[model samples]
Target chain A: AQSVTQPDIHITVSEGASLELRCNYSYGATPYLFWYVQSPGQGLQLLLKYFSGDTLVQGIKGFEAEFKRSQSSFNLRKPSVHWSDAAEYFCAVGPLRAGNMLTFGGGTRLMVKP
Target chain B: DTAVSQTPKYLVTQMGNDKSIKCEQNLGHDTMYWYKQDSKKFLKIMFSYNNKELIINETVPNRFSPKSPDKAHLNLHINSLELGDSAVYFCASSQSNEQFFGPGTRLTVL
Candidate 1:
C-alpha cells in the first residue's frame, strides 16, 4: 500500500526566515503529491501539487515544491515566512485521476516565532 | 458563495447519541468525499461518492454510514457514536483531481 511520511511533527521558524517541510512517499509508481495547509478551525487549503512535467511546481501563498523522483520526496519551500503562515501542514500521495483518494501523512505543525 | 459547505459547523452530543453531518457542493462536481481529522491532526479518508454512487469506502467503522442524495450532497450518519469519534470532519468535492474543501465540522462527543 502507498503511504506518506512527514518526518517533522513540529517546526518553529522565525518570521521572514526560509521554510522547508519535508515529505516522503512510498508508492509503486509515480505518484500524485500535494501539500495542504489548515488554519485553526478552518478547512485545509491546497498549497501545491505535483503531477508531471517540471520537477519544480509553484503554488499559491508564495510556496513551491520540488518533486524528486529518485529521492521519492516532494518538499514544500518558501523563501520567507509570515506569522499567518503558521498552521498544520499535511502531505498526501494517491491516485492521480481515479477516485482521487489520498492517504495523508501525520501533519506538521508550523509555529512562527517573532 | 461557498464552494463547499457543511451544516452544523459544531456538533456536540452524547456518546450513545447519533449525529449526521450534511455536505453540499455548489461546484457542480460529480465527486464528493468525507474525511476525518483526529485530535492529533492526522487525516484519513472515510468515504467518497461520485454522481450518487459509492466510489471509495475506506476501512471505516460500520457505524459510520454515508449517503449521497445527489451529485451535490453527501451526508454522513454515525450511529451510536463513541468518544473516539470526536474529531473534525471535512467534506470535499472534486472535478478532475484538485479538490475544494469545506470549512469543516468539528464533532464533540461527551
Candidate 2:
C-alpha cells in the first residue's frame, strides 16, 4: 500500500516569506506523487504532480516540488507566499494506473501572519 | 465552467436518517470517484467507477452505497446515517493521472 506522510501538522509563516512543506511517502515502486491545496471550505486542487520526469516540477501559484527518489520525499516550496496561500496542503501518492485511488496525507494547515 | 459539481453543498440530517449526494462532471471523464474527508482533514477513497462500472470499493461501511447512472455522474447514498458519518464527501473525476474535484458536500448528522 502507498501512504503519504506530511510531518508538519501546522506551520506559521509571515506573509511574503518563503515556505517549504515536507512530504514523505512509503511505496515499494516508483509511485506517482502529487501536491494538492484546499482552501477554507473548498475542495482540493491539484498543485503539481510528479511521474517519470525531471526531479523538479513547477505548479500553479508559483509553487514547485522536487522528487527525491533516494529520500522517498517530494517537498513543496514557494519563493514567497501571499496571505491567500494560507490553506491546508495535502500530499498524495498513487499508482501509475489512471483513475486509480490516491492515498492522501493528513494535510498540513498553513497559517500566515501579517 | 464547473468541471465537476456536487449538489446540496451542505446536508444536515438527524441520526438514522437517509441522505444522498449527487455529483456530475462535465469533463467527459470515464472514471469517477467518491472520497470522504473527516473533520481531522484525513481523506480516503470510498468508491470508484469507470464507464459506469464499479472498480474500487474500499473497506467502507455497507451503509454507504454508490450509484453510477452514467460515466459522468456518481451519486452516493447513505443509509441510517450516524454521527460518524458527519464529514465532507468529495466527488472527483479523472481521465488519467490528475483528478478534478467538486466543491464537496458537508454532511452533518445530529
Give the top-scoring candidate (DockQ): 2
Least well predicted 10-residue stretch by lDDT in candidate 1 chain A: A94-103
Off by over 4 Å in 1: none
TM for candidate 1 is 0.98
State how far residue B36 of model 1 sits from its true place (Å). 0.6
- For model 2, chain A alone compared with the true chain A gives a TM-score of 0.98
lDDT of the candidates, in the order given: 0.93, 0.95
lDDT of 1 by residue, A15-47 (tens): 999999999999998888899999999999999
Each model's DockQ? 0.74, 0.89
Candidate 2, residue B15: how far the Cα is off, in Å:
0.5
lDDT tens string, model 1, B15-88? 99999999999999989999999999999999989899998888899999999888999999999999999999
C-alpha lDDT of residue B48 in model 1: 88
Error of 2 at B22 (Å): 0.1
Chain B of candidate 2 versus the native chain B: what TM-score? 0.98
* Per-residue alpha-carbon lDDT of candidate 2 for residues A1-114, written as tens digits (9 for 90 to 100): 788999999999999999999999999898999999999999999999999879999999999999999999999999998999999999999998897989999999999999
TM-score for all models, in order of appearance: 0.98, 0.99
